[model samples]
Target chain A: MITRTLFAGFGGQGVLLMGYVLSHGAMHKGLNVTYFPAYGAEMRGGTANCTVTLSEEKIASPVASNPDILVAMNFPSLLKFEPTVVKQGLVVLNSSLIEESPSRTDIDLLQVPTVELAREVGSERAGNMGHGGSSQGQGKVLRTQP
Target chain B: MPSEKMLMRGSNVVGEAAVRAGCRYYFGYPITPQNELPEYLSARMLDVGGTFIQGESEVASINMVLGASAAGGRVMTSSSSPGISLKQEGISYMAGMELPAVIINMMRGGPGLGNISASAADYYQATRGGGHGDYRTPVLAPAGCQELAELTFVAFDMADKYRSPVMLLGDGLMGQVMEPVIFPDFIDLKDLPKKDWILNGCEGREPRAIFSMLLGQGELYHHNLDLQKKYDQITAEEQRWETKNTDDADIIVVAYGTAARIAESAMNDLRAEGLAIGLFRPITLWPFPSTAFRELAQNGRKVAVFELCLGQMVEDVVLSVGERAEIYFYGVPGGVIPTPAEVADFLRSVAKGDGEVGRRIDV
Candidate 1:
């Protein structure tokens, strides 16, 4: 089975790190994995994203066109990538930052109050980590916390 | 064992491989998608007691490499598309001087400052020699992180063995992707072979001079011929490729580097559907790997060339397949990455249009 999750948010939100942590954990488990990022040319404070693919078989392409899961940590990311999620795929949103609800009815939705959760933990900067923890529940992509 | 296995970023994997392979001198200017390479080496080189310099520009970086390599140092430089273009002159000079240096090009979409996305558009530039004069750069195209690490060692060795510049042609995806790579153990620097032609210090022996300019009459011609002889030797011995299920196949898909990875995904999907599609991937792009390709194209099999650009490597495919087989071309140029489903759909359309009035074969 192959699970591809795309994580997207503003540049400082640790979006790329979220994907890296998951892909790194998957690699330690001896599962085939690839973490591809949109590495450059992003305007300062612009959306930064990465795709993490984990599978039991050797991954073929690192480019993710359609992902099995979309973790949108900001409103712009949700607006941009919500359409690319496969039918019946999961969409995890940082509900604290995104006031709008997802329009798609065909797929499951997990609204993670990441900023609120991070605030409870004493630092809102850890919102991405909270989001990552929540998204992990959808696919169980890694056995332990990443 | 567990501690030895680190999940590394693709760009860092190459850096780690180079450090292990005894590449002690690294000079490069940072470029996007490939920035991680220089970033990793900047610190890692110091750990290995090597020199890492962020040159003023790509031109400066390549020239720095030329100086180091001529002095018998295992040197490397890396850049993305436009930055690589800036280094072309130095690359040509190094090739002409018959110097050994490793160049890593994480190709991005380009004719100019193309978008920072993976591309194979530099095939001609890398294979036919991106710089001036009559020469060819030994090009290795690795498909994944594992191959990226392994081929990095091969690239350094190939450069030293042939005393010529070698290019590792990876794309932005190849550079930016993070994956599991089991790297080989480090090479002992003391165990490496000594280069008799090095321009190092001369205590008693006559000082050797290295220059590409043979201004004397017929001097340049003879030098070209000698370089051609060396190229011929490399061509004869270094053709490398990976063929999958091509024996009974009808249309063989020819791809390398990043395109080959997507093609594999498409090939797998089609094979599961009981199709006769096969994959032919060239691990070494400059040597072209034509011997097996020509043999596989025996007696009129169809060949489909897939590339990340507007058909750069497809021309090489045309040269290899010749008149023996009909060839088709599919490409997504300028940062438009095609998915496996899209590629499989294209293949299905090709397989279904076997002998229609307007067939799938473009050549």
Candidate 2:
């Protein structure tokens, strides 16, 4: 089955990097994939996102509308993308910055305090890594923790 | 074992493909959404024993292309929307002189200096002659990264074979997107036909003139007719398109470039709902697979033309269908692309004909 993933956050949050790594890994597995940045005013530190689609068959569109997985690294990203998630899809929110939880009940929500977890490990900037690990675990990609 | 694929950005892939296609000369001005292309080729061209020049302006870059092509070199230039406008003068000159050159336009938002976003708004400019001439530029619109590279590779040959400028039309998303690509082997320039029209230091051969200026009356007129005949021959020979589930579909989504990819995804979503929706993607924007439209019209399938521009390609669709089928248009100007789900929703609503499809207008 094709899985559509959207990683949304402010610029410099490694949102694009996360998507890129995922796409790379997917490609190495011989799976069809596409990774594209949301290209507009993204250099100015507004909401930045990248969409990645991995499928056994050829991917039709690189831009995901109702992504099966939504990774929001900021509060605005969560608020913006939460409504677009498919029912019963997973929403991985960076709860360290976003104080409120998503109100949707149909989908499985994981309020991952990536920043707090990374800080506990002594480097707060490794929040993206923490989130990436959580995503891999949820997506059924076997990997050891860094 | 299968060839290992490299995860490459679309712009850099285009550059690599051009180099592999035996492009020995590169000239272009830096433009956003496609700067990576020229930047990649700048260093890489030298490795292949090719020349690269970052011209001062788009106008200068295109003129450089004209000069290189006149010298019978396989050359290329790239730009975005606004920059493409500046290159039009040189492009027209290239057409008038019947020189072969490859031009890449990673189109962005348009009209003026619109914005650096993925847009197909320059459809008219790319397919039709943006320059002042009665000529048609061959345009190839690639929807994905693989096609992005492969089309650029073929564009060089098309340009050389026809002795006219060929355009590879892409958008910002096409430039920025990353996908797996296996670079083809380098082309041997020796295998290609010799260009006898080149101005290589006149020695023992009669002097040849490659000028667009025609002073006598009816001279330019006949030249225009000859160019038109050449364009007609190209149109008759080259037309590329792809159809997905079109044979048994009730509605057909007609789109090109990046917009067509989005529409294909939406078509899949609709297919999941048991809706009989299909997609007709024109790989060549010019010589735009009008036969496909005629067949769709004959099949009596409703046509929905989606574009990133304010309905530019819709005009061509109408001309092709010509009351053979009802034509509906949905477009978003200024580089706003609808998501797949949004497109599916629009198509779903429109297929029923109960309501409009996202501001749909009947033509």
Candidate 3:
């Protein structure tokens, strides 16, 4: 029962923190987890992305071939990773920034207005965290966390 | 040193493990993926009352390691592929001078500044003694964070025990991955064994001069002979490997570091379908774990060596297995990470009643 996820956005969007939150939360709950920060592959304006894999058993590969979930905090991130999400997988996109819908219809899509939500909450930079919670509900992965 | 279970980044785990292992001096230059190691040490070293220096360059950093180790300090330095390439001369010097220091190479892309992705392309450079010398650096290739933590301690111990340079080898994936790990109790520095060969604290005895230069006739040859004897002893006793179900298996997969992780995943996927396959992982890349590896090939099992480089370690695998079994090779070069599905595809092909496995197949 391995749940592999990729969280992506520009450098300062706290995208990596989103992955860390999920990874740490899963690990704290006694699940095996591996969070891989990929610093080189960002083609759109040199952003950093990370891949997080959490499993009930030991995880073999930290580099996910096809992610079960992709939390895209920006337009380019969505554009870049939307094609790589596995079929019938989940994609939590920030509707605040990614205006276009996903091209593939096989996977599940959940859109949240994270930018406006972060602005409303008075912390404009916390937009990534707003949508990051959407994927935490996946596989009941973070249900036990406070 | 807390004994509680903790989730930490792979790089940070190494830093804390080094500190817990009684390492008091660290010198390293920043490189992509491995930067977190020095970053963690920068703050943690201060807390541990240790010394951390962001060396001006990779060469400068390894030389600093050489100096500190000569002074009998538990010291370490880390770098990525290109950075490690630059440190070879100093590493060679350390080897010839018989200094104990731990060096971590969080391997990234290739020949030149390829990319910041995981790769085991430095296998030949590491296992064959990257620097020019009649010396072999003990190499520990950790597959995950837990092993990463444990092996850091082993690397330090091996370095000091052998009075030679030691390398902790892993790819960028090992560096960036954050995983849960419970480490052992911290090693009290005072309990560590004393070294009389160091260049410092010789007030009551003759002032010690430590160097690799043996200009006298037969001096370098005798030094090389003694170093060879030490390496031979290491080869006999320090070959470390792990085998999964090789006792009753027809096919064995050989790999190390990050590549072994992928190979295990692929092997497991095949095992679910009930394939008679096993995995042979070498923890000690140098010393190469040849004896244990040779034992696994006794029953005419088909051996496959998988690596992230273009068939470097496969040569060592061939030498280990020899004509005892049918040996095959699978390689992924240039920092491209191979998925388990792809690796499984290859393994599946080999396992499906094939009359003979191909020799040196590079994919």
Candidate 4:
């Protein structure tokens, strides 16, 4: 099975780094992996994201249109990418910033207080770590903790 | 076994490789997905008795590179999509003067004012002369960090050998990701060919005049023809590509750089599913591996071209096939990267005669 994940947020929010870490972990596990980053002006602000694909076989297009997993670090990111997640896939949101819940019910949703978790970790940058483990209550949404 | 393989990001690898390649001058403005390149070079160049200039803008940086190259020093410049657009004029000038220089374009999305997303949209601009010109710049598209170093070294050699500008065409992922890279030992600059055409003080031998202008039509035509001849030579001899699972395969996937690496993953997946799919990745974008593709297509084998853009490289794939076999296109646009399973599904559909032509998804 191929698992495609998209991590998106602001420029300095470590969204891209989260994708990199997942790609590294996938590679370490001997799975085929590809990490593609966004380039150009969108990097300045608005939104930034990277696609990470891990699979049992060689990957074809590194661009993910409907990601199996979507991890949005901010409100705008969640709003922008919430529509792109595959049906019955998984969505992990930072509850501190994203006050509204996803409208979709077909997919699994995990709302974590990532900002609070980061504060506990002594850095807001650690919010991405909130996506590190299996989802709470919802078995579909896996949130891997640091 | 040697256990010292450092897990370094792609940008640092490119920077280190440039320094090892004897690139004494670097000028660049920062951009996303590739800032690590300039940052790493900033310190490394100082240690190697070289100079790195974080120019105020991409335009200024490329012009600085052109100036340094004209002075007979090994110089380089790097930027992403939008920044690359600004350096086209300088690239054209570099080509016109037959200056040997290396430029890196870590590609991103684009049409006009695009974002920082990985896209093969720059294929036309990079391969077909972005700057106003009747000249061509040899472009090397590296898929990973290893190629980041290997191609960087080769780019400098090719630039000096052809007396033309060379580009290391990569994407954001290849520029920012961390991976193991074996750095080559430094080479003695004196051992390399002396730049007789450079405009540095011509103290002894008859003063050499370096100019892109020609006084007469005959002279201009001759110069253009000369450049064409050199390009033709490169096309014939300097082409490079990698083929996987092509032996007795019914389908071949053609891609380059990061796309090619992704294709590799897809090919393996499809192969395990009892499907005969192979991968053909071009390391050199310009002087593209048309010959190999043509040879593969001649046997009535099905070929599929995969790219991050809206079917730019597919044109070349079709041209290479020459209607000998079916050539399909899988285009992933707007910063969307297709997964291996997605590719496998597409290949399966094609093998089963259920494939659709020009199918695109906006993920």
User: Compared with the true structure, what per-residue lDDT tens digits does model 1 show for residues B1-363?
Assistant: 212667787889999999989999999998888989999999998899999999999999999999999999999999988998998999999989999999999999888988888888888889988889999999999998999999999999999999999999998889988888888989999977788999778988998899988999999999999999999999999999999889889879899988888988888879999998889999999999998899998666678788888777877887887778877777888977788877777677678765431234455
Q: Interface RMSD (C-alpha) of each candidate?
A: 1.4, 1.3, 1.8, 4.5
Model 4 residue B293 lDDT?
Answer: 72
Q: Which segments of model 4 are wrong by more than 4 Å?
A: A1-146, B1-4, B31-33, B355-363
Off by over 4 Å in 3: A41-45, A144-146, B353-363
DockQ of each: 0.69, 0.76, 0.62, 0.24
Candidate 2: give the clashing pairs.
none
Best by lDDT: 1
| TM-score (C-alpha, index-matched) for candidate 1 | 0.95
lDDT of 3 by residue, A16-77 (tens): 88888888778778899988888765545668789989889988878777899988888898
Give a tens-digit lDDT track for model 1, residues A20-125: 8888778778889988888657656877999889999888888766899999999999999998999999999999889998898988999989988999999998
Clash count of each predicted structure = 0, 0, 0, 30
C-alpha lDDT score of every prediction, in listed order: 0.88, 0.87, 0.87, 0.79
What are the TM-scores, per candidate, against the unseen true structure? 0.95, 0.95, 0.93, 0.79
In candidate 2, position B177 carries an lDDT of 92
How is the predicted docking of candidate 2 categorized under the CAPRI scheme?
medium
Q: Which of candidates 1 and 4 reaches a greater TM-score?
A: 1
> Candidate 3's error at A24, in angstroms?
1.3
In the range B1-363, model 3's lDDT, one tens digit per residue, is: 556888888888899999999998999999987988999999998999999999999999999999999988999999999999999999999999999999999999888998888988898899888889788889999999999999999999999999989999988999988889998789989988799888776689988888899999999999999999999999999999998878778899998988888888888878999988899999998989888888888777888888888788888887877788877777788888888877777787677636233344332
lDDT of 4 by residue, B1-363 (tens): 222345467788888888878898999999876888999988998898899999999989998988898899899999888898999999998888898889898887787767665778899889998999698989999887767888999999999999888999998767765554567777677777787688778688777876788878599889889989999999999999988889888988888987887777677767887888888888888888889778877576787788888888877776666678777778788766666656666777667766654442221
At residue A5, give the lDDT of candidate 1. Answer: 95
**Residue pairs with backbone overlap in model 1:** none
Q: Tell me model 1's lDDT, rounded to 2 decimals.
A: 0.88
